[model samples]
Target: MSASERYTFREVTPADLPLLAEWQLRPHVRKWWDTAEPFTAQKLKDTRVKRWIVETTQRPFAYLQDYSVHGWEDHHFFSLPKGSRGIDQYIGEADMTGKGHGPAFIAQHLKALFEAGVPVVATDPHPDNTRAISAYKKAGFEVFGSSQATQWGLILPMKVSSSS
Candidate 1:
């Protein structure tokens, strides 16, 4: 945790998958995901994958989960540029969106990631996700281009500030 009173990051343990899967299967989450993508509880037990699970411990009222999905050939919303580290996350609970938690979560996580030695963090949302676009801008990510069509990608580059 940084001394600036942001969020704390914790690794997801095997015991946490039940809740994770439950959240993933929620109607709103499923709709947002738009795929019958099954996130079985057993999937969280794997340690060899490049993905990671982390939780936000800031603003006690608004909990969030960050998932760094590996794009080993799969191009999703967060497919990174050659040297970029990608970040994908969501509030994970229905009651948490539209409550101004997104910016806080992004800011805090970027701070932590920079401290941990990541020079840049990249995010690519579908061009139509207005709320996400607003939140990403609010968190200091700058749109670089709109040329991605293969997976509906909209790339943004976020440079980490030294003060963070």
Candidate 2:
């Protein structure tokens, strides 16, 4: 579908944990993950994974994965300076791919984050994923530069500078 079509954002919840876990196990999610391997059985057992469900459920948007902690590094890419929400997102559903929802979805949240006092927001996709790169650009993120790959991390910094 084109970006003109409508979509809704649902924050994650405890009730959604099983589904989230299932999604985590998908090859698509695993492909771009920061982890070198698929999430381990013990890793899945960890209580912290549940937090992605809780925090996003409370927030104004859906989470592709957690960004408030653990994921983003302390650098220009993940850093929000003073007035930013430091948000991240993903389109977890396989059916949602190549449909133009990602740019619109991200554009919505990026605007929201800016309104919430964010001065900048950044996301990094795999270097080889041109589709995601295009979607990020369509959402108004501009590439900054490249960095060394970390685990499943690839791609470069694509950032939006807020007007606040």
Candidate 3:
């Protein structure tokens, strides 16, 4: 595990659409993520979520987004603590997968969130996506319950506390 690997994040912007489009078409990414349309201009303007482009020493290779758990009415994470946030991300560069980057970057991002006074950070991976589940575990998230369907999809909710 390259625990020492470093990554940087910058907020997503209109100029990133082409890279995002190309990445979304890759088989590895397309398998687990929603359509490229999710990052529409309207989304960039949304106040409830923060979209980011993650890069390592190599290049910009992933997309990560964190949203207020209560941002959506009746959201499944609604019952979590008031200061809780939810994360969803994917490695856009296929070559970057299985390289220990996911957990390393996620852990770093979680640290930033906690430092910013977030009480908890949550994630819900698709039930069948074992890769994501394993990575989340490595990054310090604990599974809360079995897979369950929600307005989002079949999710295996997991979380890490600021105290942890």
Candidate 4:
């Protein structure tokens, strides 16, 4: 079945911490989502970001988050219009990778954000993460400009404006 038909999202909760931590340790995930410490429910609550668990018909297999660019620490992205939301996500299950799920799920999330009055959605992936960059492009995001070095690493900023 197609990813659009198999994927859905649910709010992340304390009960999901173990699964989240496990995913965080996965080699594919760790390569891009580096952190000195393990993920915890308390850490998630303390942040302003909104997070979701991406589920397939069979089981949960990914994590996703959306936060306001302006609300985050001052960055080049703040130069964009206000209410622009930024996204970060990954398919945690190794089996789920390379199956077009990333773009499908991202496009679904973007539609919901736009419908909810967000004017734009953005994502910044490490320039070397070709898989992610390709998925973002397929999901309708366009590279807004050149790559920029950030504390997180070098990122290629991309965005999708609401049709409204």
**Index of the highest-TM-score prediction:** 3
- Candidates 1 and 4, the one with greater TM-score: 4
Model 3 TM-score?
0.94
* TM-score for each candidate, following the candidate numbering: 0.67, 0.67, 0.94, 0.91
Q: Could you tell me which 10 consecutive residues in candidate 3 have the lowest summed lDDT?
A: 1-10
lDDT per prediction? Answer: 0.56, 0.57, 0.89, 0.86
Question: Which has the better TM-score: candidate 2, or candidate 3?
Answer: 3
What does candidate 2 score on TM?
0.67
Off by over 4 Å in 2: 1-5, 34-62, 65-80, 150-152
Top candidate, metric lDDT: 3
- Report the error of model 2 at residue 137, Å: 0.5
Question: Which 10 residues in a row give candidate 1 its minimum summed lDDT?
Answer: 58-67
**For model 1, how does the per-residue alpha-carbon lDDT over 1-164 read when each residue is reduced to its tens digit?**
45444555555556655665676777756554433554445654554232334344533322233334353456443454343356556556677779777777777777766777655666666666677778878888777665466543344433333343
lDDT of 3: 0.89
TM-score of 1: 0.67
Q: What is the lDDT for 87 in model 3?
A: 97
The pairs that clash in candidate 4 are: none
Return the clash pairs for model 2, or none: 83-117, 83-118, 84-118, 127-155
